[model samples]
Target: MLDLLKTPVLALQDFCVLCGRALRNIVRRPHYFDDIFLQMDIIGFGSLPIVILTGFFSGAVIGLQMTRALQTYGATGQIGPIVAVTLVRELGPVLSSLLIAGRNASGMASEIGSMKVTEQIDAMRALGTDPIQKLITPRVIATTVTLPMLTIIADFVGLVGGFIVAYYLLNLTAGQYWTPAYQILEWNDIAQGLLKPFVFALVISLVGCFYGIRTTGGTQGVGRATTQAVVVASVWIFILNLFITRIFVNV
Candidate 1:
């Protein structure tokens, strides 16, 4: 029992230490701007098509379903605001973050885990390079910067999708569909919408790096780390979303 508890406790401690170090390196000298931009291109632009596709369909589906529900009370005109609020406040960020975690988290884990198993990380240390600063910090910064931007794009695309459904199916004109959607958003909603993605970006990037750095068992370990990174990042996204929503709910 003591042994079982020890592993998780130690892993948690190591993860915390890695997070602290990586965050501290953010403002340090020898900034790897090139690597950071490469990661942003990989994580941000590479994930764009899927994010937009899913965002549109998700909002369209919600519009379809809500149209039915709202029609029960002859409130079909309210579909715009409903879809807008749901996509902006929750679905847009959550879905986009999940997609990003699945794509980039696995990539980070595999890339870094391969480096670990191949002793490349050791080689970097031998050459007087800080692996955390050179590799992990760049990823953290890229994810942090790009995730909120992606979430914003997702929210906009989703609103457009919802508008299509509303216009065609519900006979809502552009004004009817867009006006309330525009008016219903507040500073609080916008704040939380952006904030959730920022938090998720940190979790996804750090979890991937942590698992990658700790990988063992050679090739098998790299695969395991990749899988764990995606799963853990995705799980933490949901868990953190709940906590953030709870905090914002009362505010």
Candidate 2:
């Protein structure tokens, strides 16, 4: 019973230690520009299709649901601001983060876990390479840079998707939808949209790397770490979203 309780606490401590090392390495010399760019291409451009699809469908669905809700209030014309604010301030960052967590976090865990299991990470250390600097830092940098860019794309695509629904499906004019949406937005809303994803990217990448580097038990452990990485990252995204939202609100 005591061991069970201690397990999570120890894991959290180790994870924090890994995060600290990664951050410190990021600031130090010998930046791996090639690896960073490679990871950026893999993490950012490779994930675009899914991000686009998720954003478009999510916005369309929200538009559909919000239309019904607003109809009850005879305020269907207000769907623009409603959808805009919801997507920009909340849904865009949260949903995109969750999707990236599921996709990229699991991939990172599996890749690193495979290296650990196959002793490739050990070989790197034997050859005077720091796995944390070479493997983890580039991924962290790529994820941090790409997630915000992806969130912006998602936000734009989401708005466009909502506009399609509002203009065509709901028979609302472009002016009716876009004017109010643009009018209702504040700088704070945009800040919240952009900022939350940066925090979430850190959460996803670090959690994935932590789980991956710690993985044991050979192949089965790699699979388990991959699953755990996704689950933990997704939960952190939601938890972080609440705190970030509150902070943005208070500010």
Which segments of model 2 are wrong by more than 4 Å?
Answer: none
Candidate 1 lDDT over 55-165, as tens digits, reads: 999999999999888999999889889998999899999999999999999999999999999999999999998999999999999999999999999999999999999
Summed backbone clashes in each candidate are 0, 0
Candidate 1: regions farther than 4 A off: none
Best by TM-score: 1
Please estimate how well model 2 matches the true structure, expressed as its whole-model Cα lDDT: 0.93
Q: Per-residue lDDT for 118 in model 1?
A: 98
TM-score of each: 0.99, 0.96
Model 1 worst lDDT run, 10 consecutive residues: 242-251
Listed per candidate, the RMSD to the true structure in angstroms reads: 0.9, 1.4
Clashes of 2: 0
Model number with the top lDDT: 1
What overall lDDT goes with each candidate model? 0.95, 0.93
**Which residue pairs show collisions in model 1?**
none
Positional deviation of 232 in candidate 1, in angstroms? 0.8
